[model samples]
Target: MILSSPDPAADPHVAAALLRLQRTSYAREAVLVGDERISPLLEDEIGLTAWRGRWLMAWDGVQLVGAIAWWETDDAVEIHRVMVSTSAMRRGIASTLLSRVLASASGRPVAAATGRANQPAVALYAKHGFRAESDEQIPPGIWITRFRHAA
Candidate 1:
């Protein structure tokens, strides 16, 4: 049962879920990226309103299980964030979002990037057709890998 959220960014339930997910996700990354670098983005009404991307959320009843945010480029849709609730992991939420991105791309490529040491993210992207495009050092010991999946 795939249903679109009426207003993922404004929905109270969705916002709350995303806030918690952000904290947890950043906490995991802080181990490798440092707390200063991996802190969660400030999520406020204005920030949500200013987001310049398409947003999608997966819900199991009223609970948001996953979310994806992306924007269009000249020849690609760039995925900015894809997160699945800790409780809902390994149940295809991420894959479903990736599939939706692929479908909406209309034959263009989809691009995403994550920290080089985030193995789970790297594997998840690989599992969904994304192949490594580049691995670059961002200085001060930070490394990022970009991946692209042709739609």
Candidate 2:
């Protein structure tokens, strides 16, 4: 496995690949949360490039296996997305990507959110020293659990 900081904004092919990865990954997340309207599932490559967040990608010899995207605020690092292709599951891709993010946070708080029903994601955050701070309801019944890694 290799990790890279691909420029999705500057590279059309990278953006397309990232979009494909995001859709496949988030599609599973939508099923896990039982919500077809999850925002990530609806995002397009154009919308993706607009956010301008920092990204760390994990590759399996030319395959875009996983990626984590985040934004840096004045006092914290807000993780927007952590995605792993369904075919690449159980191989530690998400963990490796997240570990890299936490290591580069430089003591600033790192925040992330996942569907509250997504136990695997919650466990991953906990394994990396993140604590569940709260649960939010969006569009009424769907629950999202927010986490924070504070050093």
Best by TM-score: 2
Q: What local lDDT does model 1 show for residue 109?
A: 88
1-151: candidate 1 lDDT, tens digit per residue = 3546455456766566766666565556556554336424445545654576887778788676778888897787899888777777888888898788889899998889887887878998999889999988655566889999986
**lDDT tens digits by residue: candidate 2, 1-151:** 9999977999998899999999999988788899978888889888999888899999889999999999997688999999999999988999999988888889999999999988889899999999999998975888999999998
Give per-model TM-scores: 0.81, 0.96
Model 2 spans > 4 angstroms off: none
Residue 30 error, candidate 1, Å: 3.2
- Candidate 1 lDDT for residue 88: 79
| Deviation from native of the Cα of residue 81 in model 1, angstroms | 0.2
Cα lDDT computed for each candidate against the true fold:
0.74, 0.91
TM-score of 2: 0.96
| Residue 111 C-alpha lDDT in model 1 | 89
Q: Using lDDT as the measure, which candidate wins?
A: 2
